[model samples]
Target: MEAVNLNKKECKFVVAVDESEESMYALSWCLGNLISQNTTNNLVLLYVKPPPPVYSSFHAAGYVFSSDVIRALEKYGSDLVKSVMGRAEAICGKFSSNIHVERIVGSGDAKDVICHIVDKIKADTLVMGSHGYGFFKRALLGSVSDHCAKHVKCPVVIVKHPEKR
Candidate 1:
């Protein structure tokens, strides 16, 4: 085993993850391609869930969503975060065991939350998967990776899967 830098702080690398396969691919790519075994690194797996559904005063026929239903939804969201993180950790384990892995669950817009967390952690690099949206689609729905690349202070890596043969 290589000797880790005892005096140096762990290099922080944040990977933005979602339910999409693209995001998973990005995590794998980051592990395989970007990280080196020589340094101690903090591999933060970040999942940003949309804010919990809001129950407005006005509903159709004055019907309101039940507390049980809301709780179930929240539970589902939590499960999803755990599931994704588990998959990410499995991938990381396969690639390397030198780095420390951490999971972060945030609620809000993905782009905003990712940028905020990257800044908060003072990450050395931000990695994300590209959905490979075309120009028109990207224009219609702003690309989170593009936004991060523009706004994040640290280096941003957007990994995209190769075309199938």
Candidate 2:
């Protein structure tokens, strides 16, 4: 067996996370399998919140939603972001404490946000979770991972969670 060199240049890994079990599984897998303890690794946890809903002051039903209702919707979105990030951070905490982690929250289409952020941060690799959509479904839904794999400058890893029997 060849001896391995532990000391190497630092690598930045950008992981795209969302409020999904698949994403969390991908994050855990990346931490356990890909990250090197000897080299300084930057783990960037990225969550892209959906763009705010566009609602006219007057609804088609001829009634306008109260400001309170709008505020509640906005609050729910904010809370969801916090919840996802909190879970991601908890996973990181369970992994090697030596790995440096950063949390980035962006608002826009997920595919666009992920690709743009990966390019902007100059990530060495982009990691994402595969939802395992069927060909028909994926074609209709437009897979975000597929888009990132083609668009992002860095290499992209799409981890698929093993299905339980």
lDDT of 2 by residue, 1-165 (tens): 955445557888998888777788889988988898667889999988765543335556778889887777678778878898899999999985578999999876778988999999999889998762221233256888999999999889999877621
The residue-level lDDT of candidate 2 at 158 comes to 91
- TM-scores of all predicted structures: 0.80, 0.83
lDDT of 1 at 147: 89
**Model 1: per-residue Cα lDDT over 50-126, one tens digit each:** 64433333344767777777677667778878888898888888974588899998877678888999998899899
lDDT of the structure predicted as candidate 1: 0.77
Q: Each prediction's Cα lDDT score?
A: 0.77, 0.80
Which candidate tops TM-score? 2
How big is the positional error of residue 124 in model 2, measured in Å on the Cα after superposition?
0.7
Clashing pairs in 1: none
Off by over 4 Å in 1: 1-9, 54-63, 132-141, 163-165
Candidate 2: the clashing residue pairs are none
